[model samples]
Structure formats: structure tokens, C-alpha cells
Target chain A: MKYEILEHTADLKIKAYGKSLEELFMNAARGLMSVMYEEESSKEGKEVSDVVLETSGPDKEALLVNWLSDILLESDTRNVYCFDFSIHTINEQKISSTMKCIKSVAKEDVKAITYHGLTIKKHNGKLEATILVDV
Target chain B: MFSKEILQKVQKNIWEIPKSYREDMCVPARVFASERMLDDITTDRSLEQLVNVSTLPGIQEFAISMPDIHEGYGFPIGGVAALSVEDGVISPGGVGYDINCGVRLLKSKKTVKDIESSIVDLANQVQRDTPSGVGRGGELVLSQDEMDELLEGGVPWIIKKGYGLEGDEEFLEQGGRFDEADSSLITDHAKKRGRDQVGTLGAGNHFVEVQKVHEVLDDEIAQTFGLFKDQIVVMIHTGSRGLGHQVCTDYLRVMVQAMAKYDITLPDRELASVPFLSKEGQEYFKAMNAAANFGFCNRQVLTHLVRGSWKQIIDKKEDLSILYDVGHNMAKRETHDGKEVVVHRKGATRAFGPGHPEIPKQYQSVGQPVIIPGSMGTFSYVLAGTNESMKQSFGSTCHGAGRRMSRKKAKKVIDYNKLKQELDEYHVVARAGSARGLVEEAPGAYKDIDDVVNVVQETGIAKKVVKLKPLVVVKG
Candidate 1:
């Protein structure tokens, strides 16, 4: 399983898993998109706009937040909904990726990606992370 | 992570975790909640977050959490902290993502009986006229110059544009504008998101509800505030929308990076902040004020929309007039106990007592009106600030019923159809853009507002003036 939505009292939480760090980030992005839209159905044959995002953070966790935040900003500015992501390169300090988004309305406003109870760790020989998004 | 063993009950409805509870805490943490409410409050990390807030530099007295306190990113929702401006800090998280997320009450001469037959039509009309739901922009699209003026002038600019009525400024908090707001400090991206969002109500708990005065707790105060039993009122709850969110997102990044430069360390990245006097801090303050202005203007335009909607169905003589508007999420410079401090109220309302010069001239003899919106299908309230509030909670009070269950849990347990049926049984009409949204906001998901209000009144923070029951709810 790539991701699972978890119960939170006041926000949206997702637990995503991947065999590799890149896959973990990809799954996390998919999880966020899923929360913002109907991920599976919205992805069918829609016109896509490809854009690159580059950002640096102090660590992997911060980088993940920055990466997702950049995408959120782009989504708001371009008035589009992102459905897919490809992480070309990612490290402790920086990341570069191409996002595939379609022009569509968001189902809900994901105000910001929160750092509360945020952790990206490896367990049982697989990478896993739990993220909280303030809605 | 906080245990009940560590909390000392200070009084009947108050709990305290002293400064000694944590080594990093600069002050104590005080919580106002009933015994029953405390049980639910202890189920989450809200107390832990309150302790974290107490660690901020220059916090005075205590890091206080209201009866409606809930877990949030940095400070718990319904949290209030007064930080000394001389050497304290300003954290965006403290004011929340939605700057100036607030409540405004408009009283109408028409009573529930007068509009009983038209409640459903009024609900539908409001939902249609006021742009709501997710990603829905209002009809007003502003140019850069116009956006700048609106950001700086707030309700006055909107009124000049013919979206609001004259003399409306007197009924708003801060006169609906912050003179310190600087449009230049706000980012282009933030402006882009805000340009077309004015007068729009975004999703997630933001709403326009038509209500009736169910009971008058204090007849004199109620009469003074122009509220009578069974009288109709309109309540609008929203914020600066995408603009405020972006401003917070943008500044959190800046403060996070600047933390190293200033050699400041925090327990949580969400608490990232700079000294109030720092250049970055001032810039954020100005930008936040500008966004707050956007929120004020946004609600003002919606007020105009509501007035227009009401006029179509009700008589012209039954005009709607502003009772009061208050910002629940904000950080403002104020004096407390002879010291200047920056007060941050997140999911909390300011309730300045009588004789405060900041209050309107008409209400100078009484206190500021405190509008506490209940959860959907629940009983709301109109209260007045007290001098005891000024002494105890920095003139702050609870903002709402507070959520007992998460949205996910609400969706799991509440059938949308059944929920709608229940609202119908209560004669409370509800209209929403999405059924799922309505399910997520089921009234069962929230705490008993009566219990919450009782705690506030018993604690002497605010005095109850009137009780309001929702007659119609229009949501995003």
C-alpha cells in the first residue's frame, strides 16, 4: 500500500510507505493530492502541465515540507490541481522535481502542511512517514 | 504526552501547570475547563502544546488555554498568550493560518416568526449570492492598485466602492483597519490568491448562519446590544482565506531560516518566530495586518451580500445593522497591567470590559460584544467582556463550542441524510455545496456549547448576555 489516511481530531493525517526514500516522497505527494481531490478518477486523460520545483531545507523533513509547500503555492497561483509528482533528485539539503497538474478546482483548501507529530523514519526494512496537513 | 498527575486544579474550573513543570518553560500554563471537558482535553496533546507555548520568550503570567482548547500546530487552538513587546517574540502560528478569522453579528428587526416561512429560501439565496465552498472566488476582482488600497483601508475602501454602508466602521474591531498594515510587505503570490477571493467564504467551518435569540440571560445588556428574545440575527464566520494562509506559509519559512541567524531555538518548527522588534518580525507584523484587513473587508462585502439577500424576502423596514464584529485569531499590541505586550489570541475572542476607550462610543458604558458561534445546529451566545477578564485572561474568552470529534470521525459516524433529517426536525434549514462537507460538520462532532459557555461565565472571564439558536445555516 502506498498510503493510508489516518484519523486526526482537527486536521488531515496520512501514513505513507515506500521501499525507497524517493518512493516515500512520491507516495506522500500522492497522499496529499488524494486529500485535495479524487486522485484516481481525476487522473484519467486530463491535460497535464509539467513544471519543475527546486528548493533546499535543513533536513529531509523540512525538505519534504518545503517541496509540498512549493507545489501548493504553484497550485494556488496557476489555479490548477496537482495529480502526479516525479522526484528527480532529493537529498538532505535539496530536492528537484517535476509536477504533473491539471487545471481543476480543489475540493477543499489544504491550508498548510504542518510539522506537528511529523516523522520520516525507516521501520521493518521500509521507509515510512506520517504527515499532518492543516485543512 | 501530558498527564493529569502533573496538572494542579487551581479552582473549580481552572487547572495550572506551573513554570517548574518544564525546564524550558518561561511561565506557567493555565487552562480553563470543566471536569467533564478536561477529560476530553486530556485525550489530546493540547496541554503539551500549551506548555510549549509557555516557553516562548517574555510570556507573561501564564500561557492560557480556554475551555474550547484543542490540539493545533504550535499553540493550541483557543490559546492566548501575552508577550512583553520590549523583548518578546511574535509567532505566526500563534495567530493561526487564517489571520483575523472572526465572527460578525448583524441584528435585524425581523423576528423568527416574521421569517419562519422563508428560512429555506433565505438559506438558498444566501448560499447562491455569497460565493462559498472550496476554491470559489467572489465576483469582485481587484487590480493591484485597488487591492493595495483595500488592504490598507479595509472596510472603508469596500464601503467607498459601494459594497458596504456608511457608519459600518464604528461597529467593527479596530475600526476594520490596521493603520500599520503595509501592502508592500505582502508578497505578490499572496496578493494573487486574494485578488479574486474577496467576499468569498472558504471551506471548513466557515459559514453564514441565520439565528434567533433563544433566551436573554441579561435583559439590560441584551436590550443595550439591541438583542431581544426571538429576534433574528445573521452571523458570518470566515477569514482572510488564501491570502492569509500564504502569508503564514511564507513567513514560517523566513522565521525558520532566520532562527539560526538569531541563535533562537524552539521546541517545534511550527513555533518558529523572531523577536517583535526584529526587522523580519516587523515585516511579518505589517504583512499579517494587511491580510487581516483583507479579512475585515471580505466579511464586510459578505455582510452587504447578506443584507441584499434579506431585503429580497423581508420588508425594507427590517434592515440589518451590525451588532459587533470581533477577530478571534489575531496578535495585537496592547497594554496589560501597566506593561505593553503583544497579545496572541488563536481560536479565542477579545472581550474588553466597559469604559475601554477602544470600544465604540455607543458601547463605552457597557462591554464589547463577544460573539461565540456554536457548532452547526447548536446554541450560540452573545456575551460581554468583564474587568475580571482583563485581570485574568488578558481580556480574552472562548470562541466556540470546540470540536470534540475529528472531521474524519464525524464522517464515519454521521450519515449525511440522517444529519439533514435531524436539522430539519429542529426546523433549522441548512444548505451546502457538498453533502460530504455537511457530514464533516455534523453538530454531533462538537462539544456541548452550553457547557463551554457555562465554564467561561463561571470563571468570570465573560458574562452571558443572550443565547442564540441557529434557524438556518449556509456553508461552503
Candidate 2:
């Protein structure tokens, strides 16, 4: 799994090369938490309450947006800070994921998704998604 | 971002570039900003969208953007354009997803002096009476027929149902009624979202604040607005709620087909639009108007609740009246330059000057009142429209304190616990759907509203009437 920050803005483009799409989806969830608290240390003593989300899209870009939006909205609405996530992205049009939010007290709020530099591409050997989450 | 080649100074606070700036641009891109505000013009793709707005068919004059303009999905948040009704284009993105999300001002006879001791109770009462949070429904559940009447009748429908006040219809913009709405055009999904959401505060930058008239800038206009120093006022900032969101989501797909049918080519797919007078465009206009009417009904019903709470607390029975209600996000059909034009103002407020047939007879002598609300923990302003706005910017003005930082950044740095503590210390009661939401909307995340207000005042787009400070805020 590898990620690169896009130039000129706070956005990330990630590539997770795995034999199966499940591994790719889980890594993407980890990528999302890294943008905020970036760890599980504060969630050490907390019991896990898994929040599952199911989303589908006609295109990968829209799919990625719906997936991230679901997670972000759930985290904000529930007042749960997330550090660990496990996701299952079906090659079909949908992605199913279980998000675990850690109970931590710091960080910023996401305004909404911006269309600025949004891209999702399927390469020869890897699936890559680029998203700009408003800080 | 604007290339140095594309921009040239027209005068103070005004920048202009030719229609040839972009290949698809059909008119010049014009923006208003001071030397300071223009320094960060390249911060986002705002100028790009501003120029793209010029490409719409039948766009009259130049594409105009307010000083607080920032990049948004389809149109820049503060962008405005006027398209000819007969040949122009109507785009959903041009009005924004959160349609009719606007500000409503209500003034009470009970001053801050009278409510100081019971401020916390009042705030709590407001929070309890109004529902907050995402997917939060309300007490009133309307049937399909009632929903139709609400859409066509706007506030009058709510008023007739005993959830409105006397003189409210007159004081509100358009008497809280717009004849352009045809509820038959609204989709079942849109109606479903609004069925139980009236009087509820939807999440993200929406709130009901009990404010005190802190400063009277223009006394004559303040008097006309029935505001006095120390008087208590309530400002409800919200719109059609879930219904509006569904309306936009439903249309985005419809517009995709509309774009193909109309054969309109644009560089940005999000700006998918149909020509004015087309079946698709007229349907959207009608649907948008219906959502705007729903917004009026939402505010009207909320006002009745606030009035009841005010009456409960104050010893003396006094009138709490609606000062004005204006839609900051919308697209309207109006006559400009002797031609009927479709005006799309996304994240911008309409600032029609005096003597317009649209304004109520009472305010006809004082011009339209434009309510510009700041975020929670900040001062909101009431400004009156100016003739200069009608002549230069199609009777439009800046809406509020524009976002300088994203919501994600706000939640990251601003501590939610600390924010609640600080507000409590100041005796400003705060309530929210989520604690994190409170931090996400911290005043630090936005531009200096005073600066934004000053530009409008100096530019004569709108002049300040009275400054208001929040005593209690119910945030959702």
C-alpha cells in the first residue's frame, strides 16, 4: 500500500496493489483515518462498535465519493473519532465497509467534497483513487 | 485560477477580463474585490467556474462574482449570472444543491434587558422546540395534499394553519409567497423528504439564534426595520431541508439528460444546463420555485414556535414580528435591461432597491432588507439594498462571512469541548446535533464578517442597518 499527497492542496492519491479487491478497500479506509487523527493510540481502552455502510456508484469517482461521504458523515454525526477500518470493495458497483471510530478529542471538521482535482483511474495492475476532502 | 493575462483592473474593487479569456466563455468575467481579497484569487478554481458561468446561453451583460467568491461544484458559491428568459440556460448547479437555504429575521418587543436572566432557559426552550441533526424530522407531518398547498402558498399556508403571525406575510420578502411555484412539478421523492422535516434545523452551518441588537449603524433604516439597540431578535438560518437536497439530487440526473437533449457543450460537466423556455428548464424553474416556497413555510412555522416561546417568558404581551425573509440561494426570472432574464444567484443574496413592485408596500419606501448572517459566536448584520446594486450587479450582494477554512480543518484544530465552554462562559447558550458539529462551525474557520460587510457598504451594494449579537444558539 502506498499513497502520495497531491501538489498544491491537501489531497491524497493512493494505490493499493493486492490480489483481491478486499485488501484494496481496507487500505483505503486506513488512508482516510490517516488524514485526521492518524492513529489508534487514543482508542486503546475503548470497546469497538462497528458502523457498517453500503454504497454503490455507476462510476468509480462517484463510488469513491459516496463511500468517503458516508464514513465522514457517520463519524461527524456520531461524535466518534476513527482510527481503524476494514472495508470490502466488490468489483461490481458497490463497496461494503465496517468503520471503527476511536474516542479521541482533537481534529478538524470536513466541510464537504470538492470537485477540485478529483480523479479515479484503473491502471494496468492497480486501482487508484484520488480525493480532496475539505479540511 | 486567473492567469495574469486574463485579469485587468477596471476600478477600485472591480476586476474585468474579456469574453475571450476561455474558449467557451460567451461574455466577460467580472469580479468585485479589494486589493487584499484579490491577492488569493488563485487559491481555488473559483475564477475558472466564474468564467464558465459566462458560457451559459443568453447570459446578459458579464458574468459577475462577489468579493467573497470561492470555488463550488457547479458554480462559484458567490457567482451570479443573468440569462435571457427566451434563449438563456437554467442549470441546477447555478442555484446550488441546498436550494432556498436562507436567513429569516424576527424582532421581539422584549429587549435583551428583559431576557438577560432567562437567556439560558430561552435557548434551551428553542433547542427543545426545534429538532436538530441530520435525518431529524419534526412535529408537523404533512400529507401529500397539504404539502402541495404549502409549496404553492408558501408562508400563507403555514399562517392559515395557525403557525404564522399577523403582518408576517407583508414583512417577508414576496409576502412569503411566490406565484411561480407549481407543486405538480415536484417529484414524489422531494415531497417525501419534506413531509416531516418542517421546523427542523438541518445540519451544517444551520442554526436558530436569539440575538440582541448590538449596534444601530443606520438609525433611519434600523427604525424602518423595527430594530433598536438592546432589542432581542431571532435569526433562523436554514432552508428546504431534506426536501431541497433531494430536489437537487433528483435534478442532477435529469440535467444530465437535459444537457444531451439541448446539445449544449461545456468544459465542465457539472454545469450541465438546458436552454431557457425548454421543457426541462421550465420544469426545473417550477420545481426550484416549489422548493423555495417550502423554505418559506419552514421558516414561517418555526417563527410561530419562537413567538410562542417569547410570549411564554415575557411578562408583558408584545408583538414579535417578521422583519424580512430573503432567499440567498436561488434562480429567478426577472426583467433587466428591457429584456426578461433568468437570474441565477448561488450563495448570493438578492438586493432589490426601493420602488420595485416585488417589495412589500411598507418597505417599498425603504428598499429591501438583506439579512447577512455570520456563523455562530459572531455578529450578524442587517443591511438595506442600494440603487447601485440594481444598476451594477443585477440587484445582488454578498451573502455572509464566506468560508476561509474547510469544515474538516475546523473540526481538526478547534476543540469542541473548549468551544462549548467558551460560549457558556459568555452566557451564550449553545446546542447542536453533534458536539463535533459545534467545533466544525467555529467562527475562526470563516473570514472576518466585518470585512465582508464593509466591502458591501463601501461598494454601495448594501449598507448596514443594525449589528446583532447572539444570546442563544440552537445549531444543527
Which is the leading candidate under DockQ? 1
* Global Cα RMSD, each model: 1.4, 5.4
lDDT of 1 by residue, A1-135 (tens): 999989888998989999987899889888887888765556567788888988888888888887888888888666687766888888888998898778887786888887778889999999999888999
Could you give candidate 2's fraction of true interface contacts? 0.03
Q: For each candidate, what is the lDDT?
A: 0.91, 0.77
Error of 1 at B7 (Å): 1.7
Worst 10 residues of 2 chain A by lDDT: A7-16
Predictions in order: chain A TM-score: 0.91, 0.75
Highest TM-score model number: 1
Using Cα atoms with residue i matched to residue i, what is each candidate's TM-score against the true structure? 0.98, 0.84
Give the per-residue lDDT of model 2 (tens digit) for B267-289. Answer: 66567788868888888888888
TM-score of 2: 0.84
True contacts kept of each: 0.77, 0.03
What digit string (tens of lDDT, one per residue) describes model 2 on residues A35-124? 544454465678767778887755555556556656655554454666456665565468877767655433433434433355655677
